[model samples]
Target: MEWKLLATVFASVFIAEMADKTQLVTMLFAADRDVSRWTVFLGAAAALVLTSAIGVAAGAVLSEVINPRIMSLLAGSGFIVIGAWVLWQAIHGGA
Candidate 1:
């Protein structure tokens, strides 16, 4: 277990999830449902974990086919595009 890799995963996931829709949906679901909060929380967390695992596995396979540097560049550019879109929406008040 590389601590650095683990730390990177933790930090990236935390930052990505902080403003994610899944988190918001989870909060809304928990608020609206009559179910136990702990159950909802666990369910949401498990779903997120499974989704992340899928993403990681896909990335790993992609890395084997593509240059890692190229992958990093593409991923970074994608994040930039997403951030810009969010900023645009915030400024324009979603049209």
Candidate 2:
């Protein structure tokens, strides 16, 4: 395996996940639950793994059907939209 490629993927995924909605969902579920912390953590980790698998499969399929540049553009645009929505909610105070 190429170490450089692995490192780049690790860094990109880490950055993308750090501020993503999955973290928010994990926090919300953990806080609202009466279960043990370890139980919640394990459950959340399992769910994250499953979701990541689905994302990887989707990305693989997309790569086969679309150009890499277009796929990157779409992904970047989606992130931008989510970021803008989050910012708007912060500014307006959601109901």
Candidate 3:
């Protein structure tokens, strides 16, 4: 196993997830008096693992069809476009 790759992915995902909707939803579940924190943790972990598996599978397929450089460019541009759209919406009061 590549420890460096593992740490990089872990840190990137951990930092991104810190303030994401998943964390918020998990927090809400944990706050509910009747809900079991262990159950919430298990459910959240399972969901994340499943989603990650899908991403890995998709990437595996995509890599066979597309060059990595082009993929990176597309991914970066997609993020930029998304960010611009969000900013526009914010400026326009989401109208």
Q: Compared with the true structure, what per-residue lDDT tens digits does model 2 show for residues 1-95?
A: 99999899889878978968988877887787676778888998898789889989998998999998999899899999998999999899962
lDDT of 3 by residue, 2-94 (tens): 999999999989998998999999999999999889999999999999999999999999999999899999999999999999999999999
Model 3 error, position 56 (Å)? 0.5
Whole-model lDDT per candidate: 0.91, 0.87, 0.95
C-alpha lDDT of candidate 2 relative to the true structure: 0.87
Candidate 3: clashing pairs of residues: none
lDDT of 1 by residue, 1-95 (tens): 99999999999889989968988988888897677899889999899889999998998999999999999999899999999999999999994
Sequence-dependent TM-score of model 3: 0.91
- List runs of model 3 lying over 4 Å from the truth: none
For candidate 1, give the lDDT of residue 37.
91
Find the 10 residues in a row with the least total lDDT in model 3.
12-21
Model 1 spans > 4 angstroms off:
87-95
For candidate 2, give the lDDT of residue 78. Answer: 100
Among residues 3 or more apart in sequence or in different chains, the pairs in candidate 1 whose N, CA or C atoms overlap within 3 Å are none
Best by TM-score: 3
TM-score-based ranking, best first?
3, 1, 2
